[model samples]
Target: MKNTPLNLCTTRLHGGEYGLYVALRERADNVMNAETEPIYGHKPARYLLQEIAAGNKEYSELLLSKETVIGRRETGEILHELALLQTHLWKAGRVLRVRFLEGPEHVHRQIETIAKTWETHANITFDFIAQGQAEVRISFTRSGSWSLVGTDALTERDQNKATMNFDLSDETTSPDAFPATILHEFGHCLGCVHEHQSPAAAIQWNKPLIYSRLFQAYGWDRQKVDTNFFEQAEKALITNSGYDPLSIMHYSFPPEFTVPPTPTPHNTQLSAQDIAFISRCYPFPASSTASTLLKG
Candidate 1:
């Protein structure tokens, strides 16, 4: 291989063939071996995603663009050789200022009560205020729920613009729906990536079904789904405990979206592993030699 832009995966898997991203996504989740599987010639889950993302021009451009991977970084354009996963973490024991641009007082209070749960587990605090520049500026007017990963929120040049968005229309705010969605997005604020994107996860995604399902639900195309659910994290970037299917950060796909051995129900609370992972990442000081975990 010529080490072209397409061969960006550090491991250098197969040629970046065009349009195999779907099939590659399906096979990659099931196979795990030192040698590529002889069974139907399927490649390991990790190897396939890196190339498949690069294999198709559309997928490659969507994923590789600076805007896609941790946009608004202070310095360089290059994220990772392959930007499969991204996280920008804060130093332990830092206070993250949060400002809710607009929302009912009750709703804002509800968010604070739930989001503050992370503080019990990790060495961080959320300082919600009405004025002054905040690291995480939230708004409920947007159509979907999302947040910039950790410090990336700081890069938003416009102070009036929100770095985090939520859809809190009356129709969407069920008792269960609000908390689950907020917790997941706040996890991103704390520098966590989607749990499904973990390299160790190996979720056997029903690609066609997932595409159709998400398209109907959120109007996302295949590129968006692939970017969120297909590529596995590079082992080097993450400090993961073996894949935790129950993490609040993981998506709860319905049975139709995956093959057998279905995923856990929609997670509204952090799993034991989620608490442990955050604790590990931001361990309490032990005689002044406290350490930190680096993950995305």
Candidate 2:
């Protein structure tokens, strides 16, 4: 499809503290797949509601749209693509400066681990020395509740800073992938968008049935589901062309998540495309440009 202007849409997922974005289809001929059962076991619908109410206004707006609700899986992937697109569009060179708030060990260590991976894959240096300032904070409020907050660069009298809040006591038992989630959210803190939503998000969606199940369970309409889950990532792609379904931002919905229980190769970590996207977004530039790059 030829380059087009941004299509106006809204999100349907209920958000409370998590970031949410809607995915819109770039083309009209794409049809929905109907070969899977509608099961609500993949992702909890309540999580989507909580994300709709997240602190970030932009995030909340994107998740509450009707179209967004339709593209259940696409919502998460598109956000990552948008975050990556922002980095490329803004062109931040590669140097990244990060500040970690002195907080709990579980979340702090998880952030640190993810920070290291980001530093390696993003090909940039990150500074975590905040002295006493809390740029990124991770704490728990209650069961089944977590938060990730971030702010772009600022030039006011007060020094610019970004922060994130995570409920360590939540359902994040597997801390290995926890770093990837933190990195994904941190990408937002640095003004990054989802990699899949970048104009390059053209994955064939090998498992449409799985996606359909997610949509049905969430009670999302067709338009919202399509935009939030499939097409939005290809809307404003920053790269030439290509889709990465294995992106860390991509949801873990595979064919196996459907019915029949067949052997399907599934990945649980970030893909090579994700690493490349991160590298391109966070180019290794200078410290001064780090903040500048974070601006847009």
- Identify the leading candidate in terms of lDDT: 1
TM, every model: 0.67, 0.45
Cα shift from native, residue 165, model 2 (Å): 3.3
**What's the lDDT for all of these models?**
0.61, 0.41
Error of 2 at 25 (Å): 31
lDDT of 1 by residue, 113-200 (tens): 9899899999989999999988778888745676766555655646687878777752235786677777878887877777777878
Candidate 2 Cα lDDT to native: 0.41
Candidate 1 — which residues are off by over 4 angstroms? Answer: 1-87, 170-172, 236-239, 261-263, 287-296
What's model 1's lDDT at 14?
A: 19
| Residue-wise C-alpha lDDT for candidate 2, range 150-268, written one tens digit per residue | 22221111223223444344333344445545655555444344444555544455346535654554444566546544655423333333655555454433344334543322234
- Cα error of candidate 1 at position 69, Å: 23
- Give the C-alpha miss distance for residue 207 in model 2, angstroms: 14
